[model samples]
Target: MANSDSGASSNNYSFKVVLLGEGCVGKTSVVLRYVEDKFNERHLTTLQASFLNKKLNIAGRRINLAIWDTAGQERFHALGPIYYRMSNGAILVYDITDEDSFQKVKNWVKELKKMLGSDICLVIAGNKIDLEKQRNVPIEEAEEYAKTVGAKHFQTSAKLNKGIEEMFLDLSQRMIERAQENDLQKASELGRSSSMRRNVVVVDDEQAAETSTSKLTCCGSTT
Candidate 1:
């Protein structure tokens, strides 16, 4: 990928992803499992929203993921835009045992689409699969909804560390492909005749932050 104002380098890419869902849906647990490879038996409530960084080398490309875990409580819902406004992707998590949480994920999907449009990649995760016996959301139903929304679906068990790694990796790959396509489009446009050329500055909240540090600064947050 060509280096641009968006903080993408020749071999390095930085992407910001946010977790959205209702409280106690294991959003924090999912992030912890992917970024730290650890899980907390006791539930931890997020205050507002915080992010953590994970570095990966896939096919000789350096990918840096800034995963933002937001507070899912109803009271903090109004602050969601602050965290996800310029994110590259999103992970909508819901507990398999909670039907209401699944519905909440739909609401989040609508909000994200309305704000960020289809440019943002999305992944829908039905978490807490360890309690499969207590599952209220059927796998087929979730998968169908994900397909309808152009999002990939996964059944994740954060406690057991199942599907978490694959979920992040899949989302990252999708983001990388999207970014590369965008870069190609920009290059093609710039190659056009000089008569159509125009100067414009592209500025974004997340882009400015990413440009400050390659792959973004590493940070840690508990759920």
Candidate 2:
């Protein structure tokens, strides 16, 4: 992808991004807010996974982001690794008003690092920012955690549409830059174990997408 300020030089890029957290953290709402610019107040649990294909023009590059929303129930927890397989990026979401959710997000960050390693563009989202009065996760605390984990943090409100755009855009831009720098290949080699090749998420797909726009999993293809 091109950086307007840095001089435009780019190609079509596609990335797989997964949303993760405890149930009711507004993972679904965040993705909907980005792709449809809408929010649902009534809670709906996602089963397995649901995805959206969003195309963006950033710095004159056509970037395709295949965003996945996964179920966060304890029973569904085992499916997380499957959903996150081969993901280029991940957003660890937590309800700002729920302290447990915040803790869960931290646990998830650790799990993701173990699974996807340091190559992924990790993001921390303090969702439900509209309910500032009910906030349980302090902004400073969250920002500090993000820094510790080397993740970019954002306070977002899917209902109010705050910080959602910038968060996703930043992830996309960084992903593009990583592809351009061939950083992902290095990251993948470092993270992947030869024994777990089949268990790994779609790392090859994302790497393949570095060249072919059509090779991207436009919707859901965790494995």
Candidate 3:
């Protein structure tokens, strides 16, 4: 388990992740729980969006995560793709007690795929899981849908803080891994570029030396 709040370092990497789902499904609540570790019973619905910055360590490397909590109303859905464009990962959430909200998870996924591509890292959350008595979406069904869309699924209770930390931690870890791999690839590319530049410099130096030697020989013959 990596520390979630370690400060960034020279070896640290950062990435952006966004949360998308139907309105009132507790996307803001989940992010508030994960980033602040506090819940507000009277929090207002998110309007445009909110941003939170968190640091995480994965496999001994520090990584920074910028989380975007997006508004989920149908009217706000138009803005979802912009967030998706800049995100390296996403969390799709829905209310467990609302069948319509649960169904909208598929729509969110579809939009994300259409805009961001299928390989985007994603987690599917069934929120308000504490209201099991009122659950209109079955656990198996949600799990199946998550699997179908290749997203990780979890049941969470933002009110009780159940599964809240775990969900974000899991998503953070996945994002960290992706960031680490990306950093490694970039470092390799830079190394190759540097080596190629050095080779070019060496070749230029050799050519310059040859040209100087030829000039000297021609002057000597003329003299």
The residue pairs in collision within model 1 are: none
lDDT digits (tens) for residues 82-200 of candidate 3: 77675778888899999998888888788888876754788999999878999899999989988988889989988899987788778777766655565566678999999898888
Q: What TM-score, computed on C-alpha atoms, does each candidate reach? A: 0.84, 0.77, 0.76
State the weakest 10-residue window (summed lDDT) of model 2.
Answer: 1-10
lDDT string for model 1 (104-166, tens) is 999999999999898899999999999999999999999999999999999999999999999
How would you order the candidates by lDDT, starting with the best?
1, 2, 3
For model 2, what is the alpha-carbon lDDT of residue 83? 86
Once all C-alphas are superposed, what RMSD does model 3 give against the true structure? Answer: 5.7
TM-score rank order:
1, 2, 3
Compared with the true structure, all predictions reach lDDT values of 0.88, 0.85, 0.80
Error of 1 at 173 (Å): 0.4
- In model 3, the number of clashes is 0
Q: Candidate 1, which segments miss by more than 4 Å at Cα?
A: 1-9, 193-223
Total colliding residue pairs, candidate 2 = 5
Q: Which one wins by TM-score: 1 or 3?
A: 1
